[model samples]
Target: MNSVRNPVLRSFCGWLTALLVVASVAFASGEVRAASFQPLEIVTQSGVQVFSVEIATTEEEKTTGLMYRKELPDGKGMLFDFSPEQQVSMWMKNTYISLDMIFIRADGRILRIAENTEPLSTRIIPSGGLAKGVLEVSAGTAQKYGIRPGDRVAHPLFNGH
Candidate 1:
């Protein structure tokens, strides 16, 4: 009988297994982490920073927007770039995580923040004004990060100043 008791190898194996599980789950769940991640930054008038999110550029991707996920890690979010500023409405219909939807104008200025939306609710969440995008983050993110209408969001989809 051979006993393999190398702690380093055991640790590596455990880590590998965890990675594999996460990858499989993510893959099976349709790559919600993102097909290709992009950096999205939000800066307040007084230099306060809020979010750094991934951009969701396609209709299919935006439609999927964080549905069926058991957890949403901290400091992470999805940006649905709906281009050409228009009225926007969202729902938590198939979504499993409570979210704060931050709507932005064509120029990337925050227009509204729909906070603490109930998970799996069919309620319509609307942007009070024409918006070019919606940033979806874990519930409480808006309050926690001091994000508010008028703040600036930086991304390629916006007319950054």
Candidate 2:
């Protein structure tokens, strides 16, 4: 009788464990897919001056940018999206590469430029205390490409409003 009871209990436990495992996997996958579905694009400068940017319009996205990533391709960058034009500041915390932070106004005009930010530095890179959008690219990319303050960033998103 004792052996029979033990066998039944073991089987029940195994079944319960398997169900829990399945539930956990489903939950984890849902989370990963949600975060992976962000819309990103590679925009080029010149005609309209578009660059690749990972949309960071929300608070959550602005916080977790490119964190833990080892490398970023050329002409690739992150674009911080904002609902309204406001002064914005950025920092290089846990970031691995030096970058040129280009601040843009609501009209897509380049407002200010912060170049060569040290990797992992916690220093606050202010956007001249007023900016509606911010773009991050490899250090010197701004200069090499002749991107300068007063240059307009052409994008449909920045069309006259």
Candidate 3:
């Protein structure tokens, strides 16, 4: 007798759960803005690619990197400075746009490139080793500009050479 009602209840529950998930994501995606702005560039094999970057130097700033924004223009990014050359990790969390994480050393050389990070994911993206900074750019920026692990990051936090 109870089995007859089970399918209807399950269907209703599924719809409710999906609605809840969508609403949660929508709320989570737009809670913060970039802390500060700076001009940064990468000396890639293709050429010098300039970017308008948001500098995240403090804990609060770093934690808020590019969250809640639905769109990011080309050649723009958020730079997260870890400093002191330590192992670092990043995640998508509330970010709405996929990004390319460019892990940088203190001397301003690119160390690793984690491209096309899934939006809103909480997956831990590590630096693979010690990194002094990270630059988060819109997805496809790395391949589009030929930016690679050995590229040089031109910014005051790095060597800037």
Candidate 4:
């Protein structure tokens, strides 16, 4: 009975170890997690443009924003929340796709727009004024949607909504 029980315990331990190893590999490869997306809208002169944006609220999420992604569909984006409306800086390190970074004020007004940012660049993109959030979308998105400075953004994070 003791010998049989020992073999069964060892087999269970081995299976658990294998499962942990696979999980570790998937996490290290950055393929095990899916981003959480939220609805956002921009009211421009043309009309209201909607987007499904992933909110990056935590330090870790902000640090890893869109890194290693191969593509970003049109009307999809990531929103980085830096509350209290302070000047923020961003870079494209490890980012595979170019983006248009929209700096939004605390009142949900667009402060500035950095369009056609180079991918994988380490150059610092600065918000010219105080901003509470930064929205990153595919390159050329702003031009296609007629997004401009002073446009209103409606989301739960800002006062516009």
**Which candidate leads in TM-score?**
4
lDDT by candidate, in order shown: 0.84, 0.69, 0.87, 0.91
lDDT over C-alpha atoms for residue 94 of model 3:
84
C-alpha lDDT of residue 100 in model 1: 93
Candidate 3: regions farther than 4 A off? 1-31
- Model 4: per-residue lDDT, tens digit, 21-113? 998876556443335889999999999999999889888788988887778899999999998789999999988899999999999999999
Which run of 10 residues does model 2 get worst, by summed lDDT?
A: 31-40
- Which candidate leads the pack in lDDT? 4
Q: Between candidates 2 and 3, which one is better according to lDDT?
A: 3
| TM-scores, each model vs. reference | 0.77, 0.69, 0.78, 0.84
RMSD of each: 7.8, 6.7, 9.5, 3.9
| Prediction 3 global C-alpha lDDT | 0.87
Q: How does candidate 2 score on lDDT?
A: 0.69
**Alpha-carbon deviation at 151 in model 3, angstroms:** 0.6
Better of 3 and 4 by lDDT: 4
Local accuracy of candidate 2 as per-residue lDDT tens digits, 36-132: 2232222335433445666666677788565545566667777777647788878888777788888888887788989888889888888885577
